[model samples]
Target: MHIEIFITTNYYIGCFFIYFFMLYYCYYFYNMNRKSKRILVYGIVLLCVFGMVVVYKKNSTLPLVILNAVRFYFAGNPTEDVGYAPVSSKDFTVSVLASGLTAPTRIALTPDGEYMIVTQLTGEVFVFSRKNGVWNNKSRLAGKIDTSVLGFPPEELGLVGAVFSSDYADTGNIFFLYTYKNSEGEIENRVSVVSLKERFGTLVFSADPEVIFTANVPGNFSHQITDGIGVSIEGKSHLLFLIGEGFDAKRAQDLTLEGGKVMVIQADGSNPLGVRPYPSFPKLQAVGIRNAYTLAQNQYDARKRVLIGDTGPDIHDRIIYAPFF
Candidate 1:
């Protein structure tokens, strides 16, 4: 028989089993010679019938339709707010600006605040703008980071962060941090720049990127790549990025490896601004971070400190403070 027909027939078979079991139980209870045997058989039959009915309803579509009907009648519409209480705030009103974004990790706004670039962890960058008081997708920016080449799963190792240049209005340079497997098939994190242009009245970002910095992740273990890409609030020429411990907690303490360190590099791929005591890695600024998932500069404070949210090792997640160099 056809698969659909067989499945449908199974549902009826389950109902029949329950019906027969009940009838037999009732007949045995009234006319059985042994009272104890009757009770035991009834219990066993009830359990077997219940199991069959549960399995059948779980696999059949009819139960879903019945359940939804019951919910609608008793619980009202799922989208309707039956007992919602509105809370008012004197300072501000909150609302959703956009929806249907896939795994959005970072958002970067243009220098003029005319447009916003939202980066998804799957390597797609979407541009949104407020048109007629509603934010909508203007276009999708193109780039050349091959998400398939990453050694880890897409969610674990794809585009993590993005930041627009301070001269973005003039140069349209945008920076991104992403993960990809090197020629040796080892996972590596990279920071690159791409120039955005306009053609035919639409924004056209570069499909080819100019890679400025790259660091090799030591092992096949996934889960902690560099995150939180941002431009220095003090000077746009300086770029700040985080390097995770790459699943090795000890690497957070090691200064030699780039893992678990916050790095500063020139946007133009030149040597960093400050004088370096060690020539081995001049860009290395701060250490002892397990996995800095997010980074932000304090624009409100005059001191201009960089705030870091670092993931901990089974102990406690921490928010760290460091002065922006």
Candidate 2:
């Protein structure tokens, strides 16, 4: 059933109401004096109602593009015929480094580059070492650490990433990011620090994990928190990572919130010392990101550039690199 109401500049407004205001809006547009006004009303009403409906329904999804009024004036995302740049096989060769692992989500190499720590989506952590041009199993660093596997949309949750401290050989500190169900049964992401020790040629955890950072978002995962790494910006070691908007795209612009932002913190999760932080936010390096997937950093003497993989508001998944300093 539908109810319709008609109104104009001088016409009497109807008192009719419905579960959605679209019913009256459509009716009002039909009685518009100009075709241009009717078209404008129709376009806006349809876009908003359709988008909201998609978000509320289970299994329903929005358009691939992020809906943003600001991006409309800018050039569209760059695309190519084959989707990615092609490299010559003579210059580079791809090979499997390791196998027999289940869903390895994040990996970190020690500062000495002797051992690599790998974390799986199933919450298992393993280590591997290279010998004679071949990768060999080192040991299982951890297993069944417990992760929230509810992040199906884009699968951006779980044991997402890990980073080794600059002095990993001496400090043995490894930072891991993973998702878990909080006491309220809501999925939350946390960064935990663990010390790894080698005893009798086997790697093992040295102590109880120390929780460093915790982020709370909606249970449904679209853009959860992502990877972090240790970087020296101007010779100061700091922890840098990225986060997604987690369905609240507007919050990406909010510096007070961690969503859709780049955060720079200490290895122990304190506000980074020595270097000046990003603008007013002590922990936040940058904001206004969509789905922060992966972060890669390159440094030369103190100049550091961070490459960020972000899935967009629309179909434009992008890899953007910039220096926060």
Candidate 3:
């Protein structure tokens, strides 16, 4: 089944009201009594009038959300006695399952390998689980956690990383890494941990996220930016992440600003928590890389070697075997 996304002008109209509500609420609270109340009401009315103007203008211009659908086809022989493995076979029934997901860019399985956490770039975390051999719909992980509050640009920010504790079977701690844009037009890399519960065979995750750590990084192109994050092997509240150099690769040389660098920290502590400098690590672990978008521990390695896929300039792609020194 093919899914489609359609744009609407009311989206901006709704956004105006939301922005005005926040602004007016503060105005109403700062100065009490009839005067403030009147001001707040008048401001809200003006915002409503402006919202209609924006809605009408937007509706007159564009009405369809840009969308793209990718289809994958297996290309090999299907016969058992024949050549290469094929995507279609009698024993291997194939079907395309669709989830009502809006640009789900990242997916990770729980440490128990029982639950799948899918993150939408549009500020939504959808959790899927298998029960009796059936995949269920979304179990919202970070429901309505406004990405705008993090100061991350909507086009550039996303729930980028999710992982379970190495001891998740024993401890229910789950970790997350996402982008937030502040009012200063700076992007922040945020991390947190939460627990999952099986309520009467229904897997439910926590709503109130416990912050683990946060690092501010600069933003590049809305689409070309690169970032990476993952939990350490030992799971002693440690995390590893990569910040990109973006358009200016030289900015990574500045340590005071976490640009084009890998950062390590303990999640169970305060800001700047037990941070280890990325430059101090082994040079061979990472070399000639501009931006890294994905990070993971190689399960094949006995020591669980850290692997990074750094998206290089032009069309270059570098996969580095990064081991913690």
- Taken over the whole model, the C-alpha lDDT of each candidate is 0.67, 0.66, 0.56
Local lDDT at 118 for model 1: 81
**Alpha-carbon shift of residue 17 in model 2 (angstroms):** 32
Candidate 1: segments with Cα more than 4 A from true spot:
1-99, 137-144, 149-155, 200-202, 219-223, 229-236, 277-280
Arranged by TM-score with the best first, the candidates are 2, 1, 3
lDDT of 1 by residue, 50-122 (tens): 6555655544332443454566578654456644333766756666666676667777777666567787777
Model 3 over residues 297-325: C-alpha lDDT tens digits?
Answer: 77788777778787766777788886653
| TM-score of structure candidate 1 | 0.65
lDDT of 2 by residue, 197-296 (tens): 8765446678777778876444234577778877654555567787778778877887777788887778778777655655567888888788877987
- Pairwise TM-score winner, candidates 2 and 3: 2
TM-scores of the models, in the given order?
0.65, 0.66, 0.61
Each prediction's total of clashing residue pairs, residues at least 3 apart in sequence or on different chains, is 0, 5, 8
At residue 145, candidate 3 shows an lDDT of 36
**RMSD of each candidate relative to the true structure:** 12.1, 11.1, 15.4
Worst 10 residues of 1 by lDDT: 146-155
